[model samples]
Target: MNREPLVSVIVAVYNQERFIGRCLRSLLHQTLSSEKYEIIVIDDASTDRTSYALELFHDAIRPVANARNLGLAASVNRGIDVARGSYIVRVDSDDYVNANFLHMLSIFLEMNGYVDAVACDYLLVDDGENVIERVDCSERPIACGIMFRKEQLIDIGLYDESFRCHEDRDLRIRFDKKYRVYRLELPLYRYRRHDSNITNNAEAMRQHEANLIRKHGLDLAASNGMS
Candidate 1:
């Protein structure tokens, strides 16, 4: 396996006019060689300045606008379909990751042969983009903000269109059951929290989370019928 890998950073945006530009700025300003990696941003039919904002980075970004909003998974799948890189990533439209996010994560994936996926801790930022707290999550089946083989992603049937949120968690659970997922306890992703952000929509987000858990039948205890 090669020690240094090229990555395709994918971002799916829907009605995120306020945060899309900032998110792209961080990705576009990465320290990695621009020639090695490229940014693929899908606007997903946002009814705002998203397309206009995307036009600003036409030289560095592959922006795709839909005739109508296709939701998250569909938009992401479209980008992945055309991704030329060996590795693929999913970055939320409303959040901005650290500059070294891809560089550090890719190096680790290259170093570990058994690791099928890679994820790191993230910084929680508020609506104003102020850092609220930092979480050092070191556990199995890491969340998104990962750099891994796109083949594994395809093998798992890609993102579940049934879920608008918590799809990543469900994907992780199913994927990890068959593969070893590694975690790097570093704040590489900046997860933004705002009234407009998906997670902050308490009612909807909770419903999505519950839907994921219920659909997967995540039971802790098993009943034995044998004597």
Candidate 2:
């Protein structure tokens, strides 16, 4: 591990023992050379056997355990702080990716130096890994699948920890103001939908959405009025 990795994949997990194994497996089996990328898993004080699952791949990953549940944004920020790669990306513990995920995205960044970040399309999958739909990330963006320059992320300041929900949205808004995120139309990421998804909580999503709108001074009503 003497040479610096080209990319760092940060995984933030909370009680996702059932699917984390699959997620890590996909990352481990990436087409990208093993030495070119690093995997960092943040265990956000899960009350389940997630830690045990992490231990199974102890030799392959760098594990960081939080003493208490610090929410998603905070955990991601922690990962970013410790990452040594030139580029970084988040892969949720419940979702996995294609073998070419890292290689494709990293190559895109390498070839296009002006682009601050790049995101790929993804497939919506059920718990049984059945494909539901192929989603265009630019139209319906999610937290994962986007590879960003580590320095650019630090330049704009990291994720807003106050946002427990829609934190990705919040980060994107700020990121877009100063940098560009291009889209690579490839369904390389698999986003798993389940009953336990945080987005399932309508009330929390609403509160966070309102907070984001106000924080950014977005005039949603006016923008919609023209339509």
Instruction: Pick the lDDT winner.
Output: 2
CA shift of 94, model 2, Å: 0.2
**lDDT string, candidate 2, 47-114, tens digits:** 99999999999999999999999999999999999999999999999999999999999999999888
Give the poorly placed runs of model 2, Cα more than 4 Å off.
Answer: 220-227
lDDT, candidates in the order shown: 0.75, 0.92
- Measured on C-alpha atoms, candidate 1 has an lDDT of 0.75
Model 2 Cα displacement at 191 (Å)?
0.3
TM for every model, in the order presented, reads: 0.87, 0.96
Would you give me the overall lDDT of model 2?
A: 0.92
Per-residue lDDT of candidate 1, residues 1-227 (tens digit)? 43333788889988887888899899988877777687889888888787888888898888777788788878888888778777887888888888888888888887877789887888878888789888664432223487768888888888887777666676766676677567788898988777675655668767776776676664510110000
Residue 50 alpha-carbon offset, candidate 2, angstroms: 0.5
